[model samples]
Target chain A: MPKEKKIRVLIAKVGCDIHERGALTLLTTFRDEGMEAIYTGRYQTPKGVANAAVSEDVDVIALSDHTGSLPIIAEAVLAELKKLGVTDMPIIAGGLLTQEDVKVLERMGVTGNYGPGTPMDVILTHIRNVAC
Target chain B: MEVFLHNLTGIPRVDEAISLMKARNIRGLTRAISIVENYEEGRDALLNDAFQRASEACFTLGFTGAPGVGKSTLVNAVIRHYRRSGKTVGVMAVDPTSPFSGGAVLGDRIRMQEHNPDNGVYIRSLASRKALGGLSEATKYALYLYKAFGFDVIIVETLGVGQDEIDVARYVDVTTVLLVPGYGDTIQMAKAGIMEIADLFVINKSDRPGADLLKKQVQNILYMKAEKERPPVLNTIADQNEGIDDVMEAIAEVRQRKALQGQERHRKRIVEEIRSSVLTRLAGDAEPHLDEMAGKVLTLSMTPIEAAELIIRRIQKGCLEDDEKNSI
Candidate 1:
């Protein structure tokens, strides 16, 4: 059998909201796909996400936020990444997102937005297409 | 003296640095690690030289949780227990940095000061530097430095509550998630992502109200999930050093299990390091072009999707270059 090099990814939940089932699901999915997945757990600031991204040296960064405040949180994180000169990293966000919220994240330069109930396979595909 | 001081500010040549580290020249190694962590100019040259000098002696343990969860006190108690067993310990207490001044509060050390004068104990307080995960970028190098110094155990304490602290679990051999009873609802514990990553659950301030109920709740939840294994829950009053030995025993047992299974936590850490290094390099390479890319997107000269595609391509190119270099 060929040795598999797991593509590393960091999955984090940003902001004050503590919901993480979706984030955990993503972590599981990434690992199932033979990816080395490190989950940052919950209540991450944008800097925390970026730092995890940098330190974990992830191929992609997937953020899960079920709370409705994704716009402000996304902006805060993306802005911090920009300030830190890490704007090259791909960021994909998921959670209980509205269509409008998806639009906002898209404009903010997120790779893609996955709303609630999106299949794990679908999220995985997006992650690979954008991050790998 | 000037050369020594310069080496203190600069990265040391590897053999000299490693010899110094083995000699437990804490100031020299600490300065070297600080330079690496800060990515100070010319630090890379020093790190390359020192990288092989350290002995990789210790297993790293990361303890993390919300503020007021008694993480510092718990770490102190755990360190004290380890010291009793005649183990040499290194502690890195990560504190939050003031956003305005870029200085740290360094509060985690205050609770752990009792162990300050012990030769067996080495404690260093680090400011988060606004980096995510409440860990300094130079953490890996610092671990190597400690390992070179012959420490058997390295414990990293996080700044505050959240995902960054949880991420520490990935790097350490065993991660203990600390919970303070009555901070929030039982649902908060479940929601915090600590449920999945923590190898052991520490209910600090067990003397507090609802400690038993919280323990039962966690146990029941663990049973319901019925995963491969359930993390053991221990009650502790860290302030009083109660139940600390049991916690240490649990840690030792887990370490034994991990060793018996032939699982190299260091291998996982190395993989993480490679990934982090590659991504950081890719990101660093692409950073210089962001303004150009952003300008194209903002001026309507390039569509957002196209701009993103271009950036991704550039990052991928960088990764490819890194891969080729590593292979050679």
Candidate 2:
């Protein structure tokens, strides 16, 4: 029998963004929702997150950027993923983002622009749909 | 940069995957491990090929200890030492699966992320998946694939464990147990499970108080076993990379002296593997009928033992019928 597929998500932080509260919250939520969450901790480079996502074969790349480097970090992560030949890898961004930042990330094909105050259920539902 | 095998529609044929893996295609290796880990179709065949390609060149080392005991940090340090010697390394780090959600946060990679850019090292995190021994079933199979790819050293780090959970010892060449000050005292050290299996013991965070006392306590235990070569107990501040060289030297010494015994252990491991596979098969076959068996016992139609016997008999009969049909 084929085993049930569990949605694997890689939650990471890039650059000097030492903030972990948002990233850790998402990790806990993923686990509670029955998704395999791989946390890379803080101080990751954009390339580091991409390499990890590929190695882990995660279903989604969740970038936590409270440093407001969301657009730049998300762009780098996407570029890195593209360089790795993973054009279709889903990228999601969350954290203290302005509307302008969200628009920029979405233009780059990143989805789930979740900022603080986004309900847990909403985030979970979006991932379930995107991961499939 | 290569596309992952799973990203493609169907599972690749064993030969196709094997060739890609032989060429050191990281994506192919990752996908092959996933196949074995998830027990997908063609898993056994893939593993058969992997086992045939395995050689003794890849040395597997295991690191196990309690939670927050610096297992991952020590593993990171060891990987650095191995890389400095220009050796390729593969690491399989196991973390506990949440029994309720059936999910896990595989955070061991966090400590070892410095090697993320280094192609010479591969780190895969495994959730224990309810395996009581603090290891996942996929670990041994993943080792086969890692060996086939020709890593110079393979490391298996078990989830933070308590006094027992010595299963990692059965799968690796050397089992290094890490202890910290205040973890336990003399009687805790004398416990028969985790402490007894170590070919080497490391007192990590040795900069803390009570480190020397812990080392002496471990030595006292080793002294009781006069006939055997005493496993060395070393001190280290793993995060700072202090005393790591001594640990590496001790591992080499243990490996060299235990060469003959290693062969014997390998043979026993083969038997254990086969036994586990068969048991898993039987358990899978038995699962579907368990509810009915329980119902019968609840109704008092049969005792639990009788119900168990009936289920076994039915399974045997079904197997015999299948064999007869195949023969015809």
Candidate 3:
């Protein structure tokens, strides 16, 4: 019999994105789902986020992007992760991301881009699947 | 599938993590904090390595008080003060773990969100899992991690103060026990363990009616304890941002006096931690059989006192069994 595992997700903010209600919501949501959520708070740079991901030993990296500074911030974050030799860690984006932005993030090697209004159930399922 | 510590396939080895901590890389710091919090095997060795390499910084402080005393808000004010002076602060706000979920409500961070955008502050809400004294046993390790991470000040706010929650005294440089205005009389509140552990006293919500009497009682109690200098007592209406500076000033004075005394807090903390760890290990060895004893407890086969004694005896018995096995 396999024991149930607690999925550990490191939630980080990119750029100067100060709005993190979405991140906080997801933190409680993930915790309620029996996952361990480590929040990095706000105003994290790309390298900072990447460093936290590797250091916390989180199963996934979820970037909370509300900066509306497209591509550059997300691009810098992904590039940093790769540069640090974190090639295959599942990366997810949450908060106010549009369909077009999600496509951009996906193109940049993000495993999932969860936009606003994406059902909580779907996000939770995706996290569970990717974490396992 | 994993039994100990959060694991990552690509996670750097302990050496790399140490180097990163030296470089003040956020990831390395994060890794060290997580590893310590999880109580992974060889954690002491890893932490000792970090501690040996760490510079003397981040004079540790602890705030202890009853629930709903605005301790977190007071802490937030302190963070703002430190950030204004361009000093980095690492805060560990420990919350009670839900017995069912083993997760934190984490509402402490809500009061702290204002500092979220400031690069000078890092706030972590840890769930105290079965740890007594209003904090996880791992909190001391996390403080080491934070000190190595270069925070100028590391503040540990326990979930709430109770009769047995004086463990903060063993760990922090100076402990300020926060109390609201309407606590019982000085005689009522000044129990043995609680008063001695407090390096300072804060009566928050000074705007309330009973504030003066509470402050006077604390002062009188301190006056009677003639063996040492009395700890300074102050007032703060944390909600209105009132008297925050006085608290900081009081803390600064305490820190200065402690420094003049030659960093005895660190030495004391080490001895306390050693004592705590050894006892905790013995308790852990005894704890596994408590499940069976608990069944006996349910069925009236054994009284609770008997069950406790059985667990206590098992600790020594387990050690003897290991000794015999090693001899063979």
| Ranking 1 against 3 by TM-score, winner | 3
- Residue pairs in steric clash, candidate 2? none
By DockQ: ranked, best first: 2, 3, 1
Please tell me which model should have the higher TM-score, number 2 or number 3. Answer: 2
Which candidate tops lDDT? 2
Q: In candidate 3, what are the lDDT values of residues A1-132, reduced to their tens digit?
A: 112234678787776777879988988887777666777667766766665555446788877777666456768877777766667788777777667886887788776676678899998888888885
Deviation (Å) of B39 in candidate 1: 1.3
The C-alpha TM-scores of every prediction are: 0.61, 0.94, 0.77
For candidate 2, the docking band is medium
Tens-place lDDT per residue, model 3, B237-318, is: 9878899999889888887777776566668778888887787777667667878999999999999999988888777787
Checking candidate 3 for backbone clashes, the offending pairs are: A51-B27, A55-B31
Name the runs in model 3 displaced over 4 angstroms: A1-29, A38-102, A111-122, B1-9, B54-58, B83-88, B107-122, B147-151, B183-188, B191-196, B205-214, B226-228, B237-241, B259-268, B312-315, B324-328
> Candidate 3 chain B, which ten residues in sequence have the lowest lDDT sum?
B1-10
Candidate 1 residue pairs in backbone clash:
A42-B163, A48-B132, A57-B275, A57-B276, B14-B49, B14-B50
In the range B1-328, model 2's lDDT, one tens digit per residue, is 2222233333346666777777776666777877776777778888898899987778999999999999999999999999998888889999888999998889999999998867678888888876767677788678888888778899999999987798889888999999999877788977789988899999999999999999999998899776458899999999999999999999998888778797799998898778767766777678778999999999999999998898899889989999999999
Better of 1 and 2 by lDDT: 2
TM-score (chain A only) for the predictions, listed in order: 0.89, 0.96, 0.89
